[model samples]
Target chain A: MQPTDLTPHAEPELIVFRDVSVHFPVFNASTRSFRKRVIQVATGGIVAPDHTGHIVVQALTNLNFGIRSGERVALFGHNGAGKTTLLGALSRIYAPTSGSAEISGAVGSLINISLGTDPESTGRENIFLRAAILGLGRDFIQKNLEEIIEFSELGDFIDLPVRTYSSGMQLRLAFAVSTMLRPEILVMDEWLSVGDKNFQSKAAARLDAMLRDTKILVLATHSRDLALRHCNRALWLEHGRIKLDGPVKDVAAAYFGK
Target chain B: MLENLKAAMADIARSRHYASLIHILGWQDMRHRYRRSFLGPFWLVASTAALVATICLILGPMFGLPPEQYVPYVAAGMIVWGLIVSMCTDSCQAFISQSTMIRQTAAPLFTYVARVAWRNTLLFAHNLVIFPVALWISGAHSNMNALLAVPGFLLVLANLAWIGLVLAILSARYRDLPKTIDSVIPVLMFMTPIMWKPEMMPLRIGVKILQFNPFYWMIDLVRVPMMGGIPPGKVWVGAAVVALVGWVVALILFARTRERIVYWL
Candidate 1:
């Protein structure tokens, strides 16, 4: 088959979610052990509330949205809200429980920001590992390895094991590697500030520059100021449902309105 | 659910992106594992040698074969057997071990499976050092038939990739599988003709055991040839069938349950 035509180029990535719901079946008593499951399976099939002992967590209930290119969307929700789930769906990490989540773009994720990094390795080695997990090709990482190193301003520390670096220094390295690749859709959990005051300004500038060309930016955050400054649109998720979806000013006003 | 499976299968097939990660991760894992050890992966050789020596000392007299002939036979059998057993045990850890990567990134499930395969393959390569030395010590000559072991070895690896992928998915969901496999493998090694010779057993009993054990065919493909003997035609046929049937089942299950893997993790 011809390479399945994905979303076309020269157009913004059209991220469309239609009535998507993600239900997680809580693996409970009946399914936890082998003998119990075997007995349940042998007698025809499992029978319980919503299919035998699975307490389904309705993580995203009929979540619907359309994210086009050039849209800066901020996700706001209290803890246990669906902001992360919605982002998870968008990233294709969590498939929809029902309906659909469709996107046409090479996604770049900073979720957990430094998730795959090995602290036992040198900063340079961690960069390689993290870049690989980020889905960056070795050739690209190789070509820009120096650029990422310099940008993080890690200097000699880059040669030292990341275990030795302070948390701030480690964050700086992760931020640099994450930003190095310019993805079509840029997804972040929150506005990030790392390092001492001197380096924080540099890190912020780098993030701003990274955001400049990104076709779509989805930031999930609790800070209204961060949302208003960086996002043009807003989504307020409450208990696995969208409470509001509209312009930043209106949604923010409505959400924060006592 | 079908769509989830389809998407999972498609993502698993999209190796254009994952291959690089698999290779780098595999090599890095191997390097990282032995970074502090001076002998590095060569320790694999040392351990295998020690195991073979210990087994030979105990079993050599009982079999009534000279140590020269018996040692090569046992060492090669153990080497090939160790690799197959390790693959069976390691396969389960393929996706489960990389839960952080799976949850944080959009990496395909097979990438982690490939990581386990590649790392073990490297260790298997290290374990291979004994075969040639075994031949020399046993006073065996290098013949054209010995070259057949090369293809036989490759066939084992091909079978390994599929086996690992299948177990990676199943073991990810079922917490008991790896432990079961861990216990079952030592029994499997005892069942297969590793330290003991098939000729030593009654024809009916040995045939019955060999018929049930696919490892016999796979290891024989390498084992017989390393000893300068040709592997029987039935062995090749068995390997081909296992590899083919194994792939068909593995791909279907991979397509169906690949999405659910993360939830299990």
Candidate 2:
């Protein structure tokens, strides 16, 4: 599928949430245990019941929205407000338990920068693992291996185990690897800042370039300054429901209480 | 129902598209597992050799067979049996081990299942080195019939892949299933003809019961050929049928659970 263009024309909606809701069934030790379940069935006790013993946490509730190409959307919410769940649904990690989540663009997620890095593997090996998990091809990874190493500035330490690296260095590697892909839709839990002040600037510059190039950006964050600066549109989610969807200025004032 | 089946097939196809990822993950899993050990994956070879030696030494006289005859028989059976058992037990961990990856990425579910298959296949390759040595020690000649083990082994792997996928999905939801699989595997090993020959069981019922165990047919497909003999036509038919039927069941389970698997994890 061809990527929807950024140049303004007839804009294609890259993401559509049609009455989407994600409900997670809370399965505790007792509920998840097969032996207990079998015994329950054998005893004819709770077997024929409604099977509603397990509680369900409604993470996203009947969400309705659409994101057009070139729209930069920021998700604003307090804790337990479903910002991350909305991003998860967009990343295709959490399929909607009800309704549909239709994403029509290639998605790159910076939700967890070290999502696929194995600490036991060396820095060089982790580059491959993390990139592959981001859906980058082997050819792309191989060609840019040196560039990534140089960008992350690991140099000689790239050959050492990632577990050996300090936390700052690991984040540098993860941030570098994550930003390598040019996805049409970029999804982030929040803005990523890596390493010391020097590397943080470098990481910020890299992220800016990625944001500039992406056709659509959906970031879930609580920072008001970041929402105003980077996002054109805002979605204020409250208790798994969208409280407001409009210009960043208006939503930020309402949600952040300007 | 048909739509679910189509989606399941699509998931399987996507797994093939991510073959490179599977290969890299599988290789990394094996390497990561033995990184600190000096012998590395060769330890797999060493352990297989030790197990075969222990079993042959103890069971040879009881089965009333000479060292040369019984050693190769037990060796072939154990090699195939090791692959079968490890694949079954490891399948339970296939999804659970990749819980983080499954929750974070859009990678196909079978990619994890195939990773387990690929890693065990590599270990199986290590165990295979013992088979030739076993034959030489038992004073058996290498023959052309051994080449037939390739096709037979492929069939066995196909059956194993589906079984592994099914288990991966089921165990992802039921946390207790893996523990149950752990205990059941040892019992299955003894029930299958790994250490004992079918001839050693004098009871006609016992021999007839072996026919009912699909593990026997799976082992026979690879083991019989490695022993320089063709498996019975029925063995070929049985293994193929099991592969086909198991996959149908596996696909149905996979399709139904593909979306819910991440939540279970």
Candidate 3:
């Protein structure tokens, strides 16, 4: 691992993880009791390395990779193969337990776009609130407010609480707000296929614009077609380690058993 | 230990990084709760004032203080305690309640605690309307000592953050811990000097216990100033000591456990 890869210093063109790994300590639920923990410790039981008897699950172990600026990297693997965790690692949601991950831009994780919307708030309010949760400032949201509302196509319904909107309408409003601004790095769980056919294209267009303006993209998906269509590079993760990393056609062919 | 402290301080440095998000979310919380109501959060003030009136009437004679003196004391006590007690219990779920935010974004964890503390601060402000009116009616002087409550309130807020941080982490890990603390808080309420003053307690037991009850220092720091006098040295020293020790523990715990919080959630 290059020293530059581990440090989050001014490497503007790089998103690097030098031997990054994340381990989750599962505190045994039964021993979580005050008395049980006390009794366990008093008896000199070897509870484990953490001294609390937690069974550690290694989610991502010894992952070494780097995605440069202007590269859209698609992650491919089986479910629970750590594709999502790898994307999460890039998005800054999970700090690496060993080694280090250095992401060099404003990161937007579109894994759950509606994570910020309040059901009780109107569509317009939800748009502002949702964008703010993505770390957009107020002036920017206000400047782009009309464009977001128009893009959602819920003109009159924009004033009503989101709970009143159908789930499709809610998703559209949230998606519009989330993708309105271009982030330096965009991590997506999937292509975010939502809404009716007409709205889906609008969403795709917005996503395309976001992708065009984004400096780095790390997307996780099961669709070989989507990967081939949007990404230039592919990385296949198996049990949290990269099994393959190369150009899209090569890696996807290897991953999909060509 | 020094390295851990530095790490914790660095994590907190992100507080400014997400200051805007915290502010917007905090105000949004208050708005969410009061959105459709006609009376809005004035109902909080109305209800708090009514409780003060009722308690002052019933307990005034029991403590042998006149209505004027007792009303201001209990009112300030009630208002501050409402904020303190609720903030403590609420902190247990600060992370639990925002599990979505925790899982989805890697913003500093302090923002969630700030959100809880700030919302309670807003409510405390709303409940604060009764303090001045109570003081006016009771004819308490507005003196330089009253200005000291500003620092007192700041210390109270500092205490809330650390305590909330520790409780949030522990409870997030052990789901049952919040429940245990939840039930115990109400019992501790009766134990604290909120409904009645320390002077009202029987001398020997009261003085010794009041000196020890950390919660009493929290209330006394605010309650004493509203009646227009400096708090005794013990209140200032006791409250400051608790704040210092509590933050030292909270910061250390946060640095060691901060990364694990996402997994626990």
- How good is model 1 by TM-score? 0.92
Candidate topping DockQ: 2
- Ordered from best to worst DockQ, the candidate numbers read 2, 1, 3
For model 2, state the Cα shift of residue A14 in Å.
Answer: 2.0
* Candidate 3 segments whose C-alpha is farther than 4 A from its true place: A1-13, A41-46, A49-53, A194-202, B1-4, B31-43, B132-147
**Candidate 3, DockQ to 2 decimals?**
0.46
lDDT of 2 by residue, B1-265 (tens): 7887897899889888777778888998899889989999989889989999888888777777887778888888888888988898999999898887787788778889999999999999988999889988878765788888999999999999999998898898898999998999889988998888888788999999989998988888888888888888888888888889989999888878888998888
Regions of candidate 2 where Cα sits further than 4 Å from its true position: A1-10, A36-52
Ranking by lDDT: 2, 3, 1
DockQ of each: 0.53, 0.70, 0.46
Second chain only: TM-score per model?
A: 0.93, 0.97, 0.94
Model 2: colliding residue pairs? none
TM-score of each: 0.92, 0.94, 0.88
> Which has the higher TM-score value, candidate number 2 or candidate number 3?
2
Report the lDDT tens digits of candidate 1 across residue range B155-224.
8988988989988888776767788789889888888888887777777766776776888778889888
| Residue A166 alpha-carbon offset, candidate 3, angstroms | 2.8
lDDT of 2 by residue, A59-173 (tens): 9999999999888999999999998878889988888999998999788888898876788889998998887777788888899999999999998999999999999899999
Best by TM-score: 2
Instruction: Give the true-contact fraction for every prediction, in order.
Output: 0.48, 0.74, 0.44
